[model samples]
Target chain A: MTERLNEDQPIFIQIAELIETSIVEGDRLANEQVPSTNEFAKHYQINPATAAKGINLLVDQGILFKKRGVGMFVTEDAKQIILAKRQERFYTHYVQPLLQEAKRISLTQEQLLDFIKEGFSHED
Target chain B: MKISATDLNKIYKKEQALNHLSLTLEGNKIIGLLGKNGAGKTTLMRLIAGHFQPTSGQLEINGQSPFNHYSITRDVCLIQENYNFYEKFTIDDILKISAVFYPNWNASEAEELVTLFKLKRKRKISALSKGMLSAVGIIVGLASHSPITIFDEPYIGLDASYRSTFYDLLLQSYQEDPRLIILSTHLIDEVSKLFEEVAILHDGKLLLHEKAEDLAENHCIVSGPVKEVDKAIEGKQVLHQSTLLGQKTAILYDQEIDGNYDSLTFSKASIQELFVYLTKEEVVKHGDRN
Candidate 1:
């Protein structure tokens, strides 16, 4: 996932989210050593301090931990921590927007649920 | 290393190149010095490099004036866009001279970078193309490893690929031995992300100096219907605004959009957009007087 960072948000937050997505998607597993701040800076062509800020955010949240002079490593509960965090914001970030769009379109709640079911069926 | 300028002013005959400009830069950082042409960026850099003394005010590098002070100037390396190397000297000869001038100069790194940029060692300075000359400057700046390095539009005739190479090499060198690096360039969008802090100059004055992340967090561009946009931006510091058809878009500084405003769409104002709008507003204001 070599996607470029977007301008709509802070680069460090985007960097943190990228790492979190990797953890949740199983691309980076528990206890795995993460790339150093310098590595992230060179890859994204961003300031190393900015990249360090991103890694430190995860460290503050306990999703990652630093080893003295070694490197950063994913915490054992990183996936669970990230999943729970995302789920906590799902209602506000996703559901609220979905409901607002549906209201703007004058779609009834029943129609919205049926449409979601149909969408799920297509996935199956 | 620390650089502090207090009420610094530099005037050239009838022109006021710098007007009471004061800024402090310390520690190891990659700072972006941004401004339009004739905005006093070069004057400021030259003062820091000890090229000339300021007309008034004080500039200190580590508690001492940089002007004619070898103790301070020796640690500072300022590479301008048009570096005037001896036309008769070959590329190899210039590097050798630089090795003698800069005490911390890395000969091996300079040699490697010269090869990387594909310059002929035996070619005289006068025989190189414009882009080749720029590569020579870049090589010197990076290999010097001076504690306080300043690059004022270091990339002039270099193409896109070579510019990218310069940025990479700059970061690599900084990582190896952390130092204060001041970069001044108009190509904001391409290299803005590399700066830990950004300082914008306008009309020989300091307009803004803040952390890059803080700037990204506080400034944004919001657009929507004229009435809604007007309502959304009321009481906020609007740096720049435009209207087309029935829609209005405005750049807001130090203001955040509330999600309650459903009609308004907001996006972060990139450093380039912010610089343009911030400086453009002053130009328009000046134009009104004329």
Candidate 2:
């Protein structure tokens, strides 16, 4: 794998994050086999040991499971588990910041509700 | 599973291909054998495969010399880049030959990959494109299930999608069988992940054989304002540099850097750049013993 050698974070951590997001986004589905450690290495052009470390991190978090004679598969409850983990990061990571921005902008609840409705319309 | 190469030397006229090169590969892990053009990568592969004898040294696979031993040859499969096949023979005929040679040949696995690669068994090997021929070679290599398999630059003319498919299949096979695999390639950005240990060669000599993570950890690229980057990178071994806009980006060789700096981003060094620096005769790193 050709690793991205940016100093912002360790390459292994980036790999772990990518794999985690892959699972959460359904890029790698529940119960479906994911790439082998070496496959991750080749896909990203990284060392196999580093790839294995990233894979093992997901395994450690119960996001993925290994099948003997086969390969790694997304955990059965991957979606629910990640959703719960994401939920645990609510106020500290996202909500409080949005609220602070809203206060700074002097935004009211009605205006925010209107903004949410507009966002929903844009998606459609 | 130990292979010892001692004082191995090969010369073609004035150019020394392999210069007294000797190293031992531990068993059951992926290894990356890397070097510049004409650095004797193919020669090493052929030598270990017993295709040719070294001028001065010998290669031993599992304590037995692979030279002139059909038993060892049966278990060792070396896939040369740009493999050539007989124009008259179809892919099926080659599969049959493989079945006879390799004791652990998996027919079902071969068939699956043949279809996965969209290979036509009835087509003559001479009719396949460069990529298709590579696919045929890969099918045989994976299906052979050899104890020790070496791929010398497998993805030469392949398209991106085909290359990705090759990597997927290689990983799947390795996971299932868990044997020794060695790959040599120049497209470092595309296939660096397949390596467990990287053995870099310079002038037909082994430079370093360490983990892939270590290679990235050992080097970085620093880019920001020219003044700041230059000041911070002073006295460091700069592999390459360029000025884009008002910023300067310098490639640093092997430094311990914790990921924390204002207005500066740290990333891993490209293996290609490292190769160029390593092959150059004058570049120096104060603490780099290798």
Residue-level lDDT of model 1, residues B59-163, one tens digit each, is 999999999888899899898898558889999999999898888999999989989999999999999998999999999999999999999999899999999
What would the per-residue lDDT of candidate 1 be over residues A39-67, giving only the tens digit for each residue? 99899889999999999999999999999
| TM-score of the second chain for every model | 0.94, 0.85
TM-score for candidate 2: 0.71
Q: Scored by Cα lDDT, where does model 1 land? A: 0.92
Q: What lDDT score belongs to each candidate, Candidate 1 first?
A: 0.92, 0.78
Candidate 1 regions with alpha-carbon error over 4 angstroms = A99-115, B244-246, B256-259, B281-290
Worst 10 residues of 2 chain B by lDDT: B255-264
> What are the per-residue Cα lDDT tens digits for candidate 2 across A1-124?
2335443445677787776677778787888887787666556645566777878877888988999889888888877787888789877567766766798699998998898799999996
Worst 10 residues of 1 chain A by lDDT: A1-10
TM-score of every model versus the real structure: 0.93, 0.71
